[model samples]
Target: MLFIQHLIRLLAQKRNLTLLTLGVLAIILFFGLRPKTWPNINHAEWSPDTQGLMFHAPGFAYVDDLHTLHDRASDQSFSICLAVSSAKQLPGFRPILMFHNGSDESQLTIAQWETSIIVMNGNDYSYRLKLPRISSGDILLDGKPRYLGITTGDVGTQLFDNGTLIAEKKGLRLDIPTNEKKLRLILGNSPYGNHSWEGTLHYLAIYDKQLAPEEMAASCQLNDGIDRKNPLLLFTFLEGKGTEVQDQSGNDQPLLLPSRPMALKQTFLAPPWPNFTLSKTLLADIIINFLGFIPLGAALYARLRLSEAFSRWYPARATMIISFWISLSIEMAQGWLPNRSSTLLDLVLNTLGAILGVLVIKMSWNTMENMLSHANSATDLAK
Candidate 1:
């Protein structure tokens, strides 16, 4: 009993304020130590490979593996094929048709986009590329080439582009070319078939003449795991081969943004923060990343200081860390949701931005503190 009394007296000598501060510090440290690993968008190259090629425009070249910048390309075809099927077709001049949508912002659209060896005849043969205008990509096609009928629709076949209306319900017939012209399948708004399909790949044949039902069935195999029979699988092509993907060995296009990290897509209940951006959307951004000591930021303002536990509100860190975490997290979310990738450079930029904020705050901190002190002094004098 006497020893206990002495120990309590010694502890009491320490300031009550100090004890309170220590208690808060202990809590922060405990939770900060919790394993808080979030997702990263800027992951490495995909190992199994997604079976699609990635390309970019303005320079009309294939984007590099990073999918952030443009890479040098040997081919100049506007109707770039990102993915192709290895499902063997009777090795010959395969007549290929091309497609394009007006909303093609990537500028992969073609006016006389010629890529088919022969045109198919018939109105019922009306090709379709399944797309939801409610989504990002749309079907864009216009102008005419030789011996073919074309039409367009959004949800149902409402005849938006009347390449087929020029003829009656026989659905127009094509004069199959005796020689195979290099053909291309064009896609605009759709990035390798997600929200939009370049167009329907309805007619591929060994000869320009109609396929003998059996041959057509064999050629329709989707080598890249996509169903061409779906109305949105618009295999939009041209009358003649505009340009061919040079596989030297003639292999299918490999994955383009394979290295780009995937993301999840979730819509929050309260809507995202007004002042922050993740990809194209705005959300409440945790700006702790201006300094290198992130978990410290978490420790200081969020992890231990959190008002709610499961809520993802993390403390701001160094600009770079914040940017890295923010960019990666948002990007990875995109992958799980639908069409998205966590861009590496975005992580870099976001980090830099955070640093900028921290630097400014540090520079102005003393001045702001001094101003507040002066105001307090003035109020005291008035009292």
Candidate 2:
């Protein structure tokens, strides 16, 4: 008992150590317990060497590259080798090869669920024409206006998803002839901007031979479909994810890792924070940081019971009013400081922080006050 008392006294006397420990724990709780909301106030992050442009669908095992889009308004000729199979769904995009009627679209979305591709073109034209291979069916083209038409393209006949296009009729028709140039896919409003293309690609080939079925399956299985055969896409040996286990001892299986891209070299105004270094805008910096701190600040007020004391010092109703003014003052002052924004969002969050603080004070008041009151009474009795 004597030794325990001495240890407690020593801890109490070391104010600096106690304060440091408290601050560290508060920071950990602030970050670790945070909800999964993002664009968080993470101070330091490594930037990607080069920003990658890619698409990720919700459940599909493969990623489609936008770079493969082919575009030619009576100018460029394009060729792509593809294996058509059944495992892939409808409205599926062939890796973009030879594009037309795409000048205004930001991107194309393949809607397998609705058997459509949503083209978000700017609202200028009453109608626009799209061109793609014509497959079998008395096809119904429907959208904002919901129009129907027959379209055609030089195409092959047999292919399966998850199966390779083992063969094709030599010199199949793919491109529209100059005389029948009306073989165009069209979009218009009343029934415009949104439409469906439900059909199939017979086969895509590099040479005469069709790729093997297993090869097609493996290609679609990749996230990037990056060089699916010879040297498989893999994470680094240093990385923990996507690595294969060799033995019970947990050693590496001796696979060569690809070299990473060059690191992004940036000068940080605040060391370790490349993001903070980008903008010199004082007002913007203040606003951004103010929003960043609200949740942490609210947790602090809850732990410390600032609102309860303000109520005691003034009136019960003044709690919300007083808390808001104090929080707002801090946010406004941040304008004079570097790396901050004067955003309305920050003010909103700070006010919300105060409201949350007051709520915590009201919720815990009876229990905490009772505990403290009993402790005082016991001390007096002992004295």
Best TM-score goes to which candidate? 1
Poorly placed runs, candidate 2 (over 4 Å)? 1-105, 111-299, 302-358, 365-367, 374-383
Instruction: Quote the lDDT for 240 in model 1.
Output: 21
Cα-based RMSD of the predictions, in order?
Answer: 17.3, 18.2
Global lDDT of each candidate: 0.28, 0.30
Off by over 4 Å in 1: 1-202, 206-323, 335-337, 360-366, 379-383
Task: State the lDDT of candidate 2 residue by residue for 61-84, as single tens digits.
Answer: 111111112222222221223221
The ten-residue window of minimal lDDT in model 2 covers 184-193
How far in Å is the alpha carbon of 328 misplaced in model 2? 15
